[model samples]
Target: MAGTTLGAASPALAQKKPEAAKPAPPKLSKPVMAVVMAVQKLQQAGDHAGALAKLTEAAAVPRAEKDDALILAKLKLFSAQTIKDNAKLEEGLTEAVEAPSITPDEKLMFSKFVAGLASNRKDYGKAWTWYEFYLGQKPDDVEITVQAASVAAALKQPARVYELLTKAIDLREAKNETGDRSWYEFRAQTAIDNKMDDKLLPSLLGWVKAFPEPKSYNLAIGLVKQRQGNLDNNVLVDFGRLMSAAGAMTDANNYLEYADAALDRGMPNEAEIVLKEGIAKQLLDGSKQNIKEFVAQAASKNAESKAGLAALEKDAKTSPRLALVVADTFANLKQYDKAITWYKTLVGNAMIDQDTVNLRLAFALKNSGDAAGAKAALANVKAGPRAIIAKFMDVVIGDAA
Candidate 1:
């Protein structure tokens, strides 16, 4: 390394002077400055009433043509807070903030009051606008973020509603939250409201896993029927069966439609089963001519198959697997006598999950009018998640025979 002489240093090698300081923010006009100082003094003196009154007086001063807008905006919030007069606060702050003079921070501060006052008045569209502006300054505030989105929804902006709701759910996910049940319900409800024709099934397919309130599931099945595309009736029957497994096939129309779809698909056996469930529940709407004729046809078909099912019953007693399978089918078909008999044979089997089998047995017995037998069957489901379900059934089964 070479040594440098201090007296003759090159220009580039010279020691640097200290950098200039940043320019200060522009000063307010004299009148605005005076009002600001006066307000500060009043505040220090605990004269909030005086400070507000003075600022209210200074709004008429003309020197602060440039800064007046922002100054007045802030003054409105101060005065309103001290007086607790929300109407004037929102009115004044709203006028001042719309001027170009307001800073990002000032907008966030006063806009909250404006939004709140608007919301209290049920002026949701105006509230949504202010909240949307507030979001620019405090983008990560979850509470405000969701409130903005909700107001957007109330204003009939369904797309914005979903967009913000998803954003909130994503924010929760970032913090390792799996999403609250209410959040999922909100999402599902949004889809339902929009009649989200194409997106309905895919949206609901995951929703019920987290929050399985029956309303959403019911809407989901309705959407499924609406969304069946050009698939054959076989596919519709399969769809109905899938909903049954998901507990979405609850309504009277669902039962009747499932039977019709099955029959149209050349699936007489499936049609027979579904119609039996509908008839037993009186959901075939016997007062309707079409329903009456359809029920008569399905009952006749089921009667023709009665001998075949009886032959299988003999084998059902020898093969417990067959009994369990037949029991599930009969239970679904509402043949409680046959289902009870077969389910009892499988209730004590080591080859099956007996608790699960007993839940089915209890279901058959409950429908069979032997409520006591159903309770006894529930007693066998003493462990696992099924135990709570069995306990629920036990309480509702009513008056054991």
Candidate 2:
């Protein structure tokens, strides 16, 4: 048996001869390089489709290793964004995040991108996760933390939102950074929503101290005061103190907001008094420029007697430019006939620039149970770019006339 095996091996060795090694596959060819360059150029130019096509062609080439990975990743990212496909965007971002060669900065960028896409798609849970991951890498990013807090608030996790925003505020305060009051405002608002009014007041006061130049703080303070049944001289004095430190423009807006809040809280008489005082002091001079005209019109609409309406009519006629206010006041009072009358006058006189007056008149007429009159009014409004109004009138007339 050993002699037979030796004879067989000798025959096999004699039959085979050693061959020279084949030349290694050639490196990236010029066509492959051109395709890669084209992909890069297209990517830079924001022509994602062209970039993707070139990348696909280049990927088919032999031995395109490192460049293939980069181009593929970029193509995926661009494709997701170009088509507004959030699922694809998140998938691509996840792949990029997991890539072994991706740098820390690139990974951070991918995480943010995924979070933003998730937010735009209203997938707050996914967004929160990605934002948390990004924040883990950049714990000092107050803006990102604030954004996370906002998303959490939208998700109805108020406690989490408060925690995150408090941290962000602390970080910002320590850094002596300013601007962007949205986080502070949101935190305060969330506190109000969560029934933590006591907590809200202190935070709002702190914001006012930190950003004394903004009247928004004063307005917020006034709201709290009013909510606590303190909208009196004391509230005004506090506002005056706040105004002394705020910009003039902001101070004026704060007064206006205070009045508005008073009106909202069923204290219209107080609002009127405050508005009168503001006007008298010239703090709200810019705002009051047209308010007298509005007040006269409102008084006219609310008059019990025709004699009173006549007096208001006389005032409105004296200031024909106040027709819009007169129309709005009448509309608010549910005096549709009177509103239609004023709106028509406005339309006839070209006092209102937009077709809104005609559309409003139509609505008023309809609400007053005069569908035919509304259609007629719309027909008379032949001008003022409101073909849509005409079309709407046709529909209304077809249905109810």
Candidate 3:
């Protein structure tokens, strides 16, 4: 638009009217000029095929001048557009954008046009090239960046997609702008799809934080557990607890795994509760022998343990290990107030790991929806691996609240 024009007839001059200004015409060689005129006449005559033939002939003519090359590129671009030839369209647009006479705006427009065109045709390599070009020139354009990320995904470049989206999302966050939810969804989905272990949790966290709901919470907590290999039962129990608190325990695996974790932690009452809920929700097959046996075992153990709770509580006063087990059982069973009481009793005990006890207290407090108390408890977790875990839990509690 800025550097080239079709040889349309001049508008008739009105009496005593001044002429409207026009952009300078692109320079063309005499041989190319003659061909362009012929091609223009054929185009005006509605003979597109004939016009394309003339343009092809002109393409073979020697063009020693840069201006001639620019003019030929414009002619090819016009011909490509007229016939809707996608391949030629990209080629022409690419050539035109590289010309010295092209304006910045024109270059940007061409870049986007070719990128979209190529993507629509499933020409991912070309689309990615143009998308990168456009993004390099307009790094802050979140919309374009997302399109580029999509193209990157089409090209099977997961890391590149992650990189592009992270930059775009970070840019928006930096500017305090939030509108599109897909940005975070795409990031999380990409990481999940690719099994990017390092990035999966953070991406899901971003998604759940932006759109906190049962489904998002379920996905985030579930995927993090799925992707992270060999997590401790304690960690699995915490994840299950978080999902349960958020009303996100929707999957059969989630129920079974949660129950298994609680059972492993010696909290059969909690395991029974989880398994019973799963059966009630029809998420677990109660007719199956394994499921039936697991449920029956948990129930029996829970009943026996419940009958012994009084004696255990009496013994817990003198043993931090017993106190922690009782506290954890209460936490797993969602009796968080009782759990908090038991956990607090062991917080300052000289014989116990303060960090571990305090961290457990924080989890109990958080499960009870006392986010402030949870954070206060987390502060007592001073150092060691438990402290590191506590810091992450602090973030989780804050987000859940």
User: Each model's TM-score?
Assistant: 0.52, 0.43, 0.76
Ranking by lDDT: 3, 1, 2
**lDDT winner among the candidates?**
3
Best by TM-score: 3
lDDT of each: 0.64, 0.59, 0.75
Compared with the true structure, the alpha-carbon lDDT of candidate 2 equals: 0.59
Alpha carbon lDDT at 38, candidate 2: 73
Q: Which digits, one per residue and each the tens of the lDDT, describe model 2 over residues 1-401?
A: 00011111122211113439863432444666666567668867877767656655655665344433434555566655665545655665666676555557677767766676677677888888888899899988777787788678768998888788888888877877753677677778888889886577566655654555445544654556456553454234223322332332244555666555544433343345555666777877735546665344434333433334556666887576566656655654568788888887777664555445655676678768887876776676554224323443444344445
Off by over 4 Å in 2: 1-71, 78-90, 226-401
Q: Among all windows of ten consecutive residues in candidate 2, which has the lowest summed lDDT?
A: 1-10
Candidate 3 structure lDDT = 0.75
Q: Give the winner by lDDT: 1 or 3.
A: 3
Candidate 1 backbone overlaps, count: 1
Question: Model 3, range 229-267, lDDT digits (tens) per residue?
Answer: 687886677667666766788889889999999888788
Residue pairs with colliding backbones in model 1 are 372-400
lDDT of 1 by residue, 6-111 (tens): 1212121111234498634545777777778888788778786787678768767774566656665565555555556556556666866685766565566657
Q: What ranges in model 1 sit over 4 Å off?
A: 1-54, 62-75, 91-113, 116-133, 136-138, 151-158, 173-202, 206-210, 227-232, 264-269, 279-401
Better of 1 and 3 by TM-score: 3
